[model samples]
Target: MTNEASLGRVLEELGTTLLDVVCGDAKRSGDVGGVVIYDPLDEPELPANALVLGVGLHDPADLARVVTQLGAYGAAALVVRAPVAPDEELAAAARESGVAVLAFARGASWTHLAGMLRSLTADSGPDDAHTLGRIRSGDLFAVANSIAALLDAPVTIEDRNSRLVAFSSRQEATDPSRVQTILGRQVPEQYTRILEERGVFQAIYRSERPVFVAPLPVSDDAAQPPLPRTAIAVRAGDEILGTIWVIVPEPMSEERSQALYEAAQLVAMHMVWQRADADMERQLRAELVSTALQSGPGSLEAVRRLGLRDEPAVVLALTVVESAAEHALPAQLAAERKRLADAFAMHLTAAHPRAAAALIGDVAYGILPLLQEERAVLVATEFLARVGSRLRPLVGVGQLARDSSALARSRSGAERALRVLRSGSVSRQVALLDDVHVDALLIELADLVPRGDIPSGAVARIVAYDRENQTSLIETLRAWLDHFGDVAEASAAMYVHPNTFRYRLRRAAEVGRVDLKDADARLAAMLQLRLMKITDPGF
Candidate 1:
């Protein structure tokens, strides 16, 4: 395991940019366990020595109360919005509880702060998690800060797609556009459009040297003119990995330009290292998730390593329906599956920081740390809707598992629910096991019966008659049963006249020697028809 980061290290990295100490000695607070957001109405369980974000808690009394509570939980620090005026009671509470108090900068975002802290605190193997030259390898925040220090200007690192990766301190000193980028974590679309129209991005990507851009004119009445920017693309061989951009007043001198070019090389190295580390960690997590789901001899240890030992969670099994890519090449399907799995992992993390997801085989499994099955259903539905119908995504949410030991059972339930969906018994994309219990039971029954032989009884006779005479008797009977013996609905479903449907239904009953009026007889026919439909769609 990698060495845990101390609260002092967190302050050392972020203090110059985002945080201000209010009370307690951070250096003495030791290592922080993880970052957690404080929820007032429903407090989530905190890991030991957590760094808690006290969002929306402004009152001194409330702050003091939270500080005391966090201390009881052995939290390292409680960060509230600045500028905090620590009263005597609050100071006393902090002192008594031995919990350090910190203030989040006024303009900085809680989301960004949480993300930065998580990056610093997330677990990793020792080999890839260590520092290089006083800064953690692959730590974009530290790289951006170092670049800003060298350039004496605000900095923002962006991926090739123009998505913000990390930013330096003193963003408030930059233009309104920069502030907007920091707040949204993305360059505004209008700004990107203007750059694209001006061939600014093309120029930056095409050149290895620093490219200087003039200030953008005000695009709207309320918009401020953006400051001039100097950008250099970070490339690995022929591949452009990302760009490093600095807010500058003018084109740089030759020496500083050389420094910026050198910095791009460093940034490229970090980006590539981060990508490799991410792949390794993803594989490691996949193995742990697989082991935990098996509930085998190593399951307990795996669950502990995953930090989900005692947590109540729901298992969500997500897979692409065959109809979405039935004719696609195997490589294309594999790529799509991996893409969906990555997106699912990100979505789950955004939903709950403690949640874990991984792609196992063709299906992506997410362990959503939620208390309610209904909430899991809602989350799954929202995810499928957001992912759209391109893959025709399907998610099966299992019942809530109250602890780690129950996860295997929950996974089994989710798999059963997924099977029901894949068998085309249900029309909806997202389902809970409880919602489709009957269909799942029917699938289980089909599995129990032998696969080769035709189903027996009234449905078997109907199938044989259809095969022998090319009759519509099986279709007619299935439609009637599906419509619960409604002649009008059944006929409409089969696209035949009600009189014709009635005639076919009577002939089916006669050929099978069945009594339609008998409830037991009708029930038997319905069961057999369902089993056959599930086992053999052509029947």
Candidate 2:
């Protein structure tokens, strides 16, 4: 609550240049106050504060006189530090006088204002050398860290399941605990509210709302109320990749919080950059992948890099699964990994040597970033069928994407397609988007049936009963894995008591003597069970 007159006197001495001050009270009073610059009654300079009243003219004539005097004196703009006068009257008077009036809360005396100011003025982007080039996995990780740096706080990024994926921190450079991976674990519900409210991972569950949580108090020898914290949730469109939660031990200044919000947006950009390349591959195919993977001016500034506009394209993704543990040993495993990678690359090269292909790992993949059709099904069937015939590992294809940058989505589609193939019912084949129509087709592969296979009366009756009971033998067989065969994963999926499953499975094994572990046998049994069940619609 310093006076404009005394403040004016100090300004004459300190020579504070380019500072602007406004009267908050005048605006609401309806009486315009006189404005004065540098030496109130003297010269007006570029850095002088011009005092303008927020209210109307006390002397309507003097009001005009003061405004005329002030402008000739030099006022950059009128600012209300805190308006005491009524806004409507003051605004009307200011408008009548053709004077611009702006309002600002006299910033509170924040003890950490210097640090906060530095945060505001500091360069948010990395130095020129550190500017982002092409988006690489490592580069994307770095980008996440850079965003965390801007936040000046430890932030953990979680997926929809609340599994922590990435954490950002510049404060703890070498701390292993800060970067701990929590991807496969469930987050406590209490700690998950921030993300839930932001709809970060909520949509995956088909609903979302903002939620708040108390700052998790740190255990220490001292006792006091801990600082407050906030979190912002994030989702990849409707797909819940998870939430990006910001933890502040104490409430953040409005500026700091706003700065953090901006940083959150930047994190989203990095996610898009990192995942966009892969997404484009599934939808945009080669041209997108080609344009993305092909080297050029890597930074965002390189405008002429690739003028890729949206165009029709088909997307296919291939996964090369290499055993990491097997490849990490001290001995021949490293060499073996290299060999396998080379083989995958060569194999894929032979498949569509001209298609956009890159050796990602044990799996070689293609972006085919550029193509001219949305029909990936027919294209994949013709291309992958031939490749599957020759390749040892499998591949999958997804629907085409109109936007080239979303190619990564194809990887998910391809992964699902491979799962279908791994069911051991079909040989190498393309899984087009339309394959969803093949619920019947997937159950009907001839390869699944034994040559001239026949079911005995008892087995047939049981199969009939299973269908009549509305139980999916296909799912049950998959769940039991050939009556808990030594090679089956029955324990993992069904959480079943193996002995009981074994009894039912033994009965089923007797029906067809189905060797569930054999690829062909599992396929045949699954197909027969599916047919018997589906035909018996009542089941």
Which stretches of model 1 miss by more than 4 angstroms?
1-29, 37-43, 53-68, 76-114, 124-130, 310-314, 320-356, 367-393, 399-406, 427-429, 444-457, 460-476, 483-504, 518-520, 532-539
| Best candidate, lDDT | 1
Provide TM-scores for the models. 0.78, 0.28
* RMSD versus native structure for model 1: 5.0
C-alpha positional error of residue 60 in candidate 1 after TM-score superposition, expressed in Å: 9.0
lDDT of 1 by residue, 2-121 (tens): 434688867765644478889875675556777777877656577788888888889999988999988888888899899899999999999999888898877766766776777777
TM-score of 1: 0.78
Candidate closest to the true structure, highest TM-score: 1
Stretch of 10 with least lDDT, candidate 1: 382-391
Cα RMSD to the true fold for all candidates: 5.0, 26.8
Model 2 scores what on Cα lDDT? 0.42
Count of clashes in candidate 2: 46
lDDT of 1: 0.83
